[model samples]
Target: MPDSAPPPEFGEASHEPTEALEPSAADLSRTRTEEAVPHTAIIVPILARGVTLGVTTFFRSRRDEAFDEDDLRLAEELVARAAVCLDNARRYTRERAAALVLQRSLLPHGVPPQEAVEAASFYRPADELSGLGGDWFDVIPLSGARVALVVGEVLGHGIEAAATMGQLRTAVRTLADLDLSPEELLAHLDDLVIQVTQEGHEADPGGVSGPGAVGASCLYAVYDPVGLRCELASAGHLAPAVVTPDGTVAFPDLPPGPALGLGGLPFESVDLPLEEGSVLAFYTDGLIAAPGAGKEGLRRALTERELPLDQLCRRIVDELAPSRPYTDDAALLMVRTRRLAASHVAAWDLPADPAVVARARLMAARQLGTWGLEELAFTTELVVSELVTNAIRHAAGPIRLRLILERTLICEVFDASSTSPHLRHARTTDEGGRGLFLISQFTRRWGTRYTAEGKVIWAEQPLDPDDTPARTSGD
Candidate 1:
C-alpha cells in the first residue's frame, strides 16, 4: 500500500518506504466478529526539526466491511497531506532551539539573590520564520553607585536581526562599564553601529545588500538601592509597569527619544522612584503580542494577577507561551525594585601584611559600630582577617578592603595579585589554601573581579534569620 501523507519540504527530500498492513486472517476474523473492518484509513506523521518524530493513524469502517485497494489509495492521499503539516512544525522547532541557545549564551547564567530586591530575566525568539530578533537585557554593577540596566529590541528578524541584537547588547555593556549616562551611552552605540556598517561597506569589494542594520528601541535604567531611585531612558520603547503592594499600579510615562540609528535626533533620560513593596516590570513587545490579544490582555494579566515583576515575567511564558510553544522568538527582563540603607567604602594603598588587615578589620568594625551595624562589623572583620592573611602569605604590595552594609553584609578584599584564590579540601596536617572555598561555603555569595590595579575578592552574608547558620573555612 502507498504511504499516506504529503511530501515534506525538508532540506533533504524524504523517501518513505511502503509496507503492507499487518493483519492475519485470524485477526481479520476477530474484526469481522466485533463489527466489521476499516474501509478507509489515514496516517499522519508528527515531525520536529524537519524529521518525522511520530505518527498518528486513523481508520473508518464502511458497511462493516474490511478495507480494500481503493480505500488504501484514498488513505495514501490523506497521509501525503499530513507530511506537509508535520514538516512545517519541525522547521519551527529547529528555529526556536537555535534562538534559545544563542540567547542563553548572551545573558548571564543567573543572578544570585540580592539585598532589598529580586531580579529575574528571560529571552525567547519570535516565531520560527521570524528567526531571532534583537531583544536583550543587562544588569551591570557600578562603582559605589547603582545597578545599571537595559532592555532593547531591534526592528527586524532572521540571522541579520540576531547579529544586530548581539552587537547592540555588547555595546550597551561596554558603554555602561565606562560609566556613561544612558543618553551618552546610547549615542556612542548609535555612532558605533553606523561606523561599523560604513566600514563593512568599505571592506566589501563586491556589491552587498542594504544599509548595515537599523537602530533599535531600548529602555536604559539605573536602580540605586540606597537612594531608592530608578533613573531610566525610554527610546521608542514601551512604558514600564510600576506594580504596587496593593496590586494597583500603572505604567510610568517618559520623555520621548529617538531609537538608535536615527540620525539628527536627541534622546532624553527620565528618573523615577521605586517605593517600598513595589514591583517594576521591564519587558519586550513579545510579552504583549499574543494572537488576538493586545495591550489590554497584557494589562489585565499584570493587574489581575498581582504578581511581582520577576514572577510576572515567568508567568508570561509559563502560562501563555503559545498552546504548542511559541512560533516566534521572544525575550523578557524583569526586576522587583526596592530600597535599602546600604553604604560601601573602598580604601587602597593600605599595608598588605597581616597586621594591616587586622587594623583594617578593626577600622571596619568601628565604622560599622558607629553606623549601628555591630553584627555586620564582626562578620566583616572575620572575612577580612582570612583574606588579608592569605594576601600576606602570597602577594606583596598594598591591599584594600570595601565594607558595604546593605540588607546583607558584604566585605571586599583587594590585593596586588591576579592569581585567583584557591579553594580545596584540606587534611588535618594541611595549613593553607582554603580561603575561597571556606568563604563560598559560609557566605551567601563570593566572587573575585579583575580590578585595574590588581584583583578584588568579595563576599556577601545574608542578615535573614531564616538562612542557614552553618559555617566553613577557606576549604
Candidate 2:
C-alpha cells in the first residue's frame, strides 16, 4: 500500500471515484511528504486455545518492498507460540499464589506458651519456580506438664502437598490430645496415610495420585519436664539434634520406621534423658539439603544455646540457607528443656480403703501449707478427698495421690484400672455419685490420663482467686 493513500476508517468501506479530480496544491504537498518516508505495518492476533489474548503489530519503515504473505504467516506462528507461553505463565502465577496462601493459613501462627519447653520456629517456602512444599512444625502442650514437638514433610510441592501437610498436622494434634506414646502416634498416622493413599488410588487408577500419595515422613517427640526425658519416634525422618548444657551436640541413633503409607513396619520410641537448659533441634531435610549447609554447619549454628530461641532460629536459617527463595520448603523448631523442681511436687501411696480418704486430704492440706498455698488448702483438700474416695470405691489395686505446685495447684489420683471416670449429676437422694460433681465444683479444670501402669485423674485449682476469672476450664 502507498503511504499517500488515506487510512481506511474502522467498519467503513472504500469506494473508487467515478471520475478523476485534479489534486489541490495542499494535497500534492502532503503526498510528496508521505512519499519521502514510506511505512507499512501488519497486525497479527495472538491466540491461545482459539481465544485471542492480544495483537502483535510489526511495522516496516523506508522499506523497498512491502510485507508479503510469507511474513504474515511467520508472524502468526510466532505469536501463537508466545501466546501459549504467556498463558502458562499466568496460570502458574495464580496457582502458586493460591498454594502459598493456603499453606500459610493452615500453619500455626505462633507457638502457644507452655511450661514444659520454651520453643521457637522458622519456615521458608520454596522459590517461585519450584513452588511451595509440604513442610510443617508444631509444639503442642500435653497433659501432665508435658509437651509434644512435631516436624513433618510431604513428598511433592504446590497446593496438593500443602493440603496434605495440613491434614497430617491436624491428625498429629488429635493424637497428641490422647497422650499417645510417640510410637503409637506414628502407628496411627501411618494407618491414616495408608487409608488416604488407597482412597486416592481408587479414585484415580491411571494417573499419579496427590503429592503425598506415595508417602511422607514425620518426627514426633514428647518431652516430660517432670521426668526430665524426651520420648521420640520417627517415620523415615532424619534424627533430631540435641545440644547439652555443656555445648555438646549429638544425634541419637533413632530407629527409622518406614515412611507413612508403607504399612508393615513397626515404629519404636527412644527415651532420651535431657538435662535442664539443653537445646533440642528438630527440622525438615531441606535445611541440610541446601548448598553449603550440613550437619556440621547446623551444629555450629546451635552451639550458642544461651541465645534466645527466636534469634537462634534466625541464625540457623541464615547460616544454613541464607539465600532467599529456597529450592525446597524448610522448617526448624528448637526447644530448650525445663525441669519442674522437686520441691514443687509431692506424691504418696495410699491403700485402697474408705478410711484413707481423710488421710489423703490431710496429706494434701499439709503439702499446700508447706508450699505456702494455705489459702487454697480448703479446695485442694476437697479435690483430693473426692478423687481418692472415687478411686478407692470404683477402681482396683493401689491408689497414689500426687500434688504439684505450679501456676496452679494440681492434685492427681492414680489407680491400676484403666476404666475412665465419668462426671455425673447426682440426684438429691444419691450419696455416692456426688463426689465427682463436688470435685468439679471445687477445681478449675480436671481430666484423666492413662499411663503404662494405671490411669491418673487430675484436678487443677487456681492458686489465686483473681486469676480464675481470666481462665477457662478444660474439663
Candidate 3:
C-alpha cells in the first residue's frame, strides 16, 4: 500500500501478491524471504456508514491457488457484516459509559449522620445485559428524630430509566420535607408519575415510549426513634424484611399498592414497632429474584444478625446473585433502630396562665443544667418564657412544654390551637408582637408543626457552649 493511493470507497477491494507489493514500515511483519512468502493476498477495507475503520487481509501459502475476484467479493461481504457489528459495539460502549456516570451522580453519595437510626446501603447496576437499569436507595432524615428509608427501581434500562429514577427520587425528598406520612407521600408521587406519563405520551403521539413512563416500584418507610416504630407503605414493591433483636425474622404483611402512574388503585400504609437493635432491610426485587429462591430466601438470608449492617448488606447481595453477571439492577438499604430513652426527654403540662411562664423558664434552666448545657440556659430560658407566654396568651388551655436532649437542645410548647406562628418584625413601640421575635433571636432555629391535638411551636439551640449568646437578660 502507498500513501499516495486514495482510501478505498464502498464495495471496493484491493488485491496484492508478495511479488508485486512494495514493503512499508507497517508491513514489516508480513515481509518474508522469497521461499517463505505467500503467493497472493486479498485486502478489504471495513466501512461503516461511509467511514473506513480498518481493513481485513487474507494470505495464501506457496502451494495454495492464487486469490481471485470471487474470493475478493466473499471477503468484502464478510467485512461488511463485521463493520455493522463493530459500529454497534462502539455506540453501546459510549452510551454505557455515559449512563454509568449519570447513575452515580443521581444517587446519594454518602448518608448523613442521624440520631434516630444507623443506615447503610449498597447498589449494583446490571452492567452486562441491562445498560444502567434504574435502581436507587436513600436515607432521608426527617423531623422529630425520625428517618425515612427509600428504595425504588425503574422498569426499563438505559438513559431514560436513569433520568426517571432521578426525577422520582427528587419528588420523594420534596414530599418528605412536607412531613407527609408514607401513604400520603406515595399518593403524591403517584400523581407526579401520572403527569410525567402524560407528558411522555404527548411528546410521542404515536404511542408510549422511553421506559414506558412511570413503570417503577417504590418502598418508603419513616422510622421514629421516640416510639421505636416504623410506618411503611409500598407501591408494587416487595415487603421489607425486619429482624428483631432476639433474632426473629418477619416480613410484616404490608399491602402492595398498584405501581406508580396507575390511578385507579389507592395505596396503604402500615405501622410496626421495631425494637432497639432491630435490623430492617429495604430492597428492590432484584436482590431476591434468584432462579428458584424468592422472598423466602431473602428472609432466611436476613435472619443472620452477627455481622454488622454494612457487612450484612454486601453478604446478602453476594449470596442472592448468580455466578453470571446480574440481569437487573439491585439496591439494598439497611437501618438499625436506636430509641431515645425516657431520661433523654422531659415534659410538663401547664395551665394557660401568665404565672406559668415563670415556672416554664425555671424548668428549662433546670433541664439544661442537668444535661450539661448550662451555657445555653440563658437563651433557652428566654425561648421557653416567650413560647409559654404566647401559648397562654393567644392559644387555648392544656399547654405542654417538652425538652428533648439529642444532637441539639430542643424546646417544644404544645398548645390547643392550629394557628401557625410566623416570625414578624415588630417596631420599637409594638408591645405585644415581639414574643416570637425575641424567641427567634435567642435560638438557632424555630418552627411550628400541627399535630392531631394541636400545634407545637419548637425551637432548637446549639448544644455547643460557644454557640450560646454572651449577653442575656439573666446576665
Candidate 4:
C-alpha cells in the first residue's frame, strides 16, 4: 500500500488463490478470535496544495459497521481544509517574527548623554495576532547645546509598516542634523512623504493608492538648553504632557497640522519656556488609548515627576500601557529640561571693523583659559577670527560672538544679514573665500543657522584633541 493509502485489514488475502486450501484448526481458531474483536481503522493524509503536512488516523471498534470509502473521503477533505488553515497561521507567525526583528534593530539601542536634557525611552510592540505596528521615538543631539525629541507612527501593521517607520526615523535624523526648526523639519518631512507616496503609486498602479498607503503622524520638538525653551511642531500627532518640578501637569495646545502625505498644509511651531527640572513626556497615542487609560490616566501617571527619568518612564508605562500585549504599538520618551550654566557661556558684541577682530580673539582666548581649555586656544582663535571677519565683511550691523562650554567648545557668530556663508575652494592665486573653508578644517564640525535677527555661523571644537579624530573639510 502507498504511504497515503489506508492499511488493509489484518489477515486479509493479498490476491485470490487459484485453488483454495482447506482451513486448518489453528487458522480457524485465529479467524474466530479476529471476528470476536471487530475493529477498523482509516488513515488520511493532511495535504495542503501539493504537500502532505501530516496524517490523521480514525479508529472504530465494537460496532457492526466499519469505515467505508465515503468515510475516508470525508476525513481527507476535513484534514485538507485544516492543513491550509495551519499553513496560513505558520506564514503569519514567520512574517511577524521577521518584522519584529527588523523594527527592533532599526530603533536606537541607547541614547547618548547630552547637555540639554536627561532622556529615557520605552517601546513595546503590538500583540502577536495583531503583528507589529510602526511606532518609534528618538533623542537626537543637535549643535549649540540643543536636542531634538521625536515620536512618530505609521498607519497599518506588518513588515511594510516597520520598514516605513525606519525610513522616516532616518529622515528625521538627517533633517535634524541641518538644525532645522521643528515646523520647518515637519514641512520638509511632509514633502518627502508625498514624494514617497507618488513613487509607490507608480510602482503599483493597480494596487490601493491614496494617502492611506503611506499615512503617518509625527511630533518633532527641539529643546535649547541655552535659551531654556522648546519649540514643538506636530503632523496630526498628540501633544506632549508637561510636568513642572512642583508636580503640576499641563498639556500645551499645539497646532495640529495635517498628517504626512497630505499636501498643501503648513505646520506651525510653538515655543514653550520651561523651568529647570521640568519633565516633558512625549508619547504616541497608543499609550493613552490603552484599556482603562486615556488622557486623564496619562496625566495621573506623569504626576510622579520626582522619580528618576528611567524610573519615571517605566512607571508611566506600567500604569498606563503595561507589559501586556496591546492592539497598537506604544512608545514613550521622557526628558528633564536643564539649563546651560551662565559660567559656561560667554558672549561679546563687536563693531564691524577689522580692528575688533583682534579684540574678539583676545576675548575668546581669555574665556578658554578661564574654562581650563587652554590647549584648544590656538584653534579656537583661528576659528573665531575667520567667522568674525566673514561676518564683518559680508554681514551688516553689529556682530555678536558667543562661546559655549560643554562636552565640546562651541563658537557662534551672529549678524543681522540673512545670507548664509558658503564654503568655497580657493585657487592658489585667490585671497578670499577661504574663511569658511578654514573654519571648517580647524573645527570638528561647523554649520550655519538662521535667527530672527539674522543668521548665526557656528563651529564646534573638540575639548580633547587626542580623544577625538579630526574629519575632512567635506564633513
Which candidate wins on lDDT?
A: 4
Worst 10 residues of 2 by lDDT: 11-20
User: In model 2, how large is the Cα lDDT of residue 64?
Assistant: 41
In order of appearance, the predictions have TM-scores of: 0.54, 0.77, 0.78, 0.81
Q: How badly does each model clash, as a count of residue pairs? A: 26, 0, 0, 0
Candidate 3 positional error at 159, Å: 2.3
Best by TM-score: 4
Quality of model 4 by C-alpha lDDT: 0.82
Clashing pairs in 3: none
Among all windows of 10 consecutive residues in model 1, the one with the lowest summed lDDT is 10-19
Model 4 quality (TM-score): 0.81
Q: lDDT for model 1, on a 0 to 1 scale?
A: 0.66
Order of models, best TM-score first:
4, 3, 2, 1
Model 4 clashing residue pairs (backbone):
none
Q: Give the TM-score comparing model 1 with the true structure, all chains together.
A: 0.54
- Candidate lDDT (C-alpha), each: 0.66, 0.80, 0.80, 0.82
Candidate 3 lDDT over 1-475, as tens digits, reads 3343465556578775544543343344444434444557788888898888898988765444567778888888899999999989988778778877887788999887678888888877776443466888888876666789999989876777888888888989888866677888999999988987887778878974665446688999999888889989999998888889888888899999999888778999999987899988888888877685578788788888878889988988888875566767878898888998889899999998898789889988888888887888888888888888888877986999998888777788899998877777788898778877777677666777666788878877767857854332110
lDDT of 2 at 309: 88
Q: Write the per-residue lDDT of candidate 4 for residues 341-365, one digit (tens) a residue.
A: 9999999999999999999999999
Q: Residues 313-334, candidate 1: write the lDDT tens digits.
A: 7776554445544654456666
Instruction: Give the better candidate number (1 or 4) by TM-score.
Output: 4
